[model samples]
Target chain A: MLSCEQATRLTSERQERSLTLRENTELKMHLFICSGCREFGRQMDALRSLIRRQPGDKPPED
Target chain B: MIPDSDIADLRRDMLAFARLQISDPHLAEDAVQEALAGALKNAAAFARKASLKTWVFAILRNKIADLLRSKYREPVTTTDPDCKHCAPADDQYFDDNGHWQQDTQPRSWGDTHWLADNADFWKVFDACLNDLPAEQARVFMMREFIELTGPEICATLELSSSNLHVLLHRARLRLRACLSGQWFGTEESA
Candidate 1:
């Protein structure tokens, strides 16, 4: 079992697309069993949604 | 003496990309103009090593950096104290029943209709993006908002894949932490 710190780091890495499959699986497994980490993941998702909504100066076209 | 059509295209493209990096519409416009001027003056140096879009974007990034540096000597911070509720506690996922629980699954989390649906939420959201570390924020904006690919970002920022990944990871994590504080009541002090 990965430590909470290791799981946290891996989860962040996975979110960034920097983690290897092995690392991702380890983190996913850890999350499956750990409520805190699972919550962290959910929060991470919520955060992504919020950031996407942030209005920038760019026009509608790109 | 650049052609008007090319200049128009460049203006449109640069404004779009600049908006990703800069929240201020006026500043983004100014930065795009400055970048176009620099690119035209330095046209002789263009070797076609990268796409014209990438080359232009690199120049725009530099201009944006300069503007940000001048406007805020210190890093940007959140003005909303209420925005602090989004950060997660170490124990937040657990239920009162002592069972491991998740309020929402990650897949369903992509449904951003709720956030996009609210104007007030966006006010705090934009502030959170500004609060991110500058480089990471730049990368995230380029990748996510501007739809730049990894290789394109690597070429533009001159970052290796590993370095880019790390920078992006840090940026996303920080943004997530910041937004969570605002939207989800996760505690900004965390």
Candidate 2:
């Protein structure tokens, strides 16, 4: 099993490029049992979307 | 038809984005203004398929690319500020065994879409982003915000693939920690 550090590293690398099959399988297995790594993965995705939003995009009205 | 308010908004946003990529305020302004003017001049030719903002951003990106090409033609040397081996603070997240440190374990950031649109959240986001080492922030923005391909960024920044990957990885790690500490996992909440 990949450690949290290695799993998280792969999560970030996934953003940059396609992971090999072995890497994909290992990361998926790690994420399945680790809520911390899963949350880390989600946060990374959130960060990407937040950064991609244009500066002009205003907050939705309450 | 593009409304006047929309143009104003796009101009402001474009300038902000350009300034993130280019250090010089004047140069960033110049690129944005030129892009706005070009977009206006060819407004009739704009296809309806893509959002107007996307089209204008493309023009601004082209201008920035040209500026970067001219400004950074010389291959980055070892002495370059970015090339300095500044050790990232991200190592604190993991233990010697490469597991997440007990105190630094990631927690759920509930309702991220809601946070994404929260203006206060964006302020925290910007602060977290700005706190990153300058080159890391710039390269991260280029890769994520500007949608530059990996090869494109390597060529433009004169960075090797490995170097670029490390910068990007560290940037993400730090940003996640900062955002969690400041917003999602605040002392009262976590």
| Proportion of native contacts kept per candidate | 0.14, 0.51
Write one digit per residue (lDDT tens) for candidate 2, span B71-103: 745554433345453355477888988888877
What docking class should model 2 receive?
acceptable
lDDT of each: 0.58, 0.76
Those runs of model 1 whose alpha carbons end farther than 4 Å from true positions after fitting are A15-19, A47-62, B1-112, B188-190
What lDDT score goes with residue B116 in model 2? 43
**How many backbone overlaps does candidate 2 show?**
0
- Model 1, range B18-137, lDDT digits (tens) per residue? 776667898888888877776666655654423444456666765665564456344223233332222333343235543333432122223555665465765676687788766777
**Per-candidate chain B TM:** 0.46, 0.69
How does residue B178 of candidate 1 score in lDDT? 61
Task: Give the Cα error of residue B117 in candidate 2, in Å.
Answer: 3.0
TM-score of chain A of 1: 0.75
